[model samples]
Target: MGLIDRFQALFRPKDRENEPATVAMPPPRPSSVLARFNVEQGRRATVEEARRMYDEDPRVRGIIQTLARDAVKNGFELVVEGPRAEEAQDVAQAMLERVDFWSRIDDWVRLTLRDGDSFLEVAANRQGDIVEISRKPTLEMYVRTDEFGRFVDPMRAYYWADRLASVSERPPDHAIYFAEWQIVQASWDRDEGSRYGQPLFASARKAYKRMTEGELDIAIRRKTRAGMKYVHSLEDASEADIEAYKQRNQAALNDPFAAVADFFSNKRTTIQAIQGDARLSEIEDVLHHIRTFWMASPVPMSLLGYGQDLNRDVLDEQEKQYRRTLEQVAQWVTGQFVRPLLIRQWLLRGIWPDGLTWSVEWASKEVSTVAVLAEVAKAVVALRATGIVSDETLLRMLSHVMPDFDVKAELARLREGRPDEIWRMAQLAGGQDGAA
Candidate 1:
């Protein structure tokens, strides 16, 4: 097929006439014996509620945003490795600059982290240039899969004042799907063949709620006076008098700007301040819950701005693990999002490099100190001087320390006998030979 034809085929909606028209209904609950309950409806409701909470809940927003930002904070660059690597890299760079690929991916990451799954619809003009890319919420889209659990079609429902007005099938190939985790069932017939993804915070909802409550309790404690027990003699005071006295005391205590005044009373009321040990314990419990949340999430405590007392080695290991996860996400994004868009862009422009294979390289999560970089550079230079490795190898080693360093450009300069300033400085230093 030609480029347009292939693109069309990839996105063509299935014929509605060929298939039985079935109204979309919630899948039956697995717990139901007769399959009367629509558990899928409940799940959809839950996902919707979770989405709402993610938007409204400050703690949820903070946690998810932190994860999303950190995942792509290092950012990513497209790397093409093959005979036409340089040409492909140039194309990738152009595509990035034109489209703001990193920013788009950052947005996608945030959505996926918030919703557990994110869908992007790619629209191209007749010239094959991507005109727009938009995100579709999972709540608005319903995916259908074949008997074998493969995606068949996705339907988008439009709502008018929260009532479904029309349902339209999205062109299959026009959408890119990113799911962090999928819920698969053994009996595909019993469930929606398309996988359902739950957000990372879904399981920790209760813990988060408890932590929030604990924080609120602490705040209330900080603002309010400690509880006091009043011992009043019933012999002299009527119930009405006792009630009035209690109300006055509460009003005085609750008023933020009220000043305390000692009053002499014949009732002989002895007041003692409530101990704050319980409030402190509750605060500790909140911390425990937070730690539990960190354990459940892919993010480490250090990444979320905790773990200040952690040793450097431990923090490094945690960051390494987190970066590894981001790297995997980068790989998945490259395949699911970048590749197809780039291919479409290339076909539109009629520019296809031979043996083109592209991958993504994330910037280093750990910033190397100058001392560390200098020491590593010294070792690499020594190795190069001993003829143990070539200049290309040295450049590759330095690329780890300085990701922006263009190894290919440096190699080309060396081959053409046009050394850069660094090379000239090295030569000059060597010529000095401690003469000064």
Candidate 2:
């Protein structure tokens, strides 16, 4: 049986057509005026609003982009360990390269941060050779749920079967479902038993709004100098003179020949500018709002280049803690993102339980200097001299030090005993594009 057939057989109950949702919103309270007012006006920010913030706000975009990019900055690879491992690993690696896996993964991270949930769709050819990988917009897509509000097998999820309903559809139908074995959801910071993921910046939305409004207020204050006003200084004069002066001042303010217009004012009025001081000199409050917004985001201040006030030691300590956060994201990528694809791809090819095993080994940035890498290379070379472990084993051990280390190519060259081959492979392994 196919994947869908299998799921149907296992989980499809008799009332498939009429399965009542066991979860729903509580009934509205009609008696309380406060409840009615809240129902009418108190709408919360949504996933779409978070996306808008990511696109339009620099601080928000910075927090999300920084976390997403740095988490994958080191790199990652699928390492197959046993029987037929080389062929499987090679196929998977080539598939990833063809689809530009690294760039696509970066996009996935960004979308997940923006939308709180993201999705990926992977497909193979008729011969079960892995071929296609694509990112799906979370807004345009959704998952299926059973009666209990659990995503029906979130790993190999069920797609909404209303089947690409019109965007104009109000309260669209998400009732029917169809199963696809090759799709996966990448969600973080989700509530238990909830169908959707929480966006990274969801909690800080109010702060984001305040910060933007503050910045705008500051700009207006600086540019316009907090509104202009005309103070008519009258000596001991009659009401007629005061009225005439007011008319003349109004004319000057409205005169097209004047340098300042209704909003901008005229110089002939001997004006005392005092129209707007709403926050003319209160810039410090805006700064405070900005700091609050940054503090509310998931990223640390150090990651966002916030080290001016901090000493070297303090910055270094924060850096360490931030690295730990990145490591956690990496682990999630391995399990939630990488492993699902590998397993589903294998299951599609019927290669399960064939004594083959796979592992994910993510790379880290080359913080080690040339001397350190050389020392590692030297140690590896000594281990190779013992003739105990195969060269393939040794290279896999050091693959984390350099991504794209060609294990098979190096093994062939070592067997051939080409004197220059080791140097060439070493250079290539270090991300040298055109090493001689």
lDDT per residue as tens, model 1, 209-262: 676787788777765644443344434677786776666676654564545644
Residue-level lDDT of model 2, residues 309-365, one tens digit each, is 788898778778777787788887776677767666665555552467766767764
The positional error of residue 232 in candidate 2, measured at the CA in angstroms, is 7.4
- Which parts of model 2 are misplaced by more than 4 Å? 1-45, 147-157, 161-176, 220-285, 296-298, 302-306, 353-355, 366-394, 402-436
Error of 1 at 275 (Å): 5.6
Q: lDDT (CA) for every model shown? A: 0.55, 0.64
TM-score (all chains, Cα) for each model:
0.67, 0.67
Task: Please report how far candidate 1 places residue 114 from its true position, in Å.
Answer: 1.0
Candidate that would win on lDDT: 2
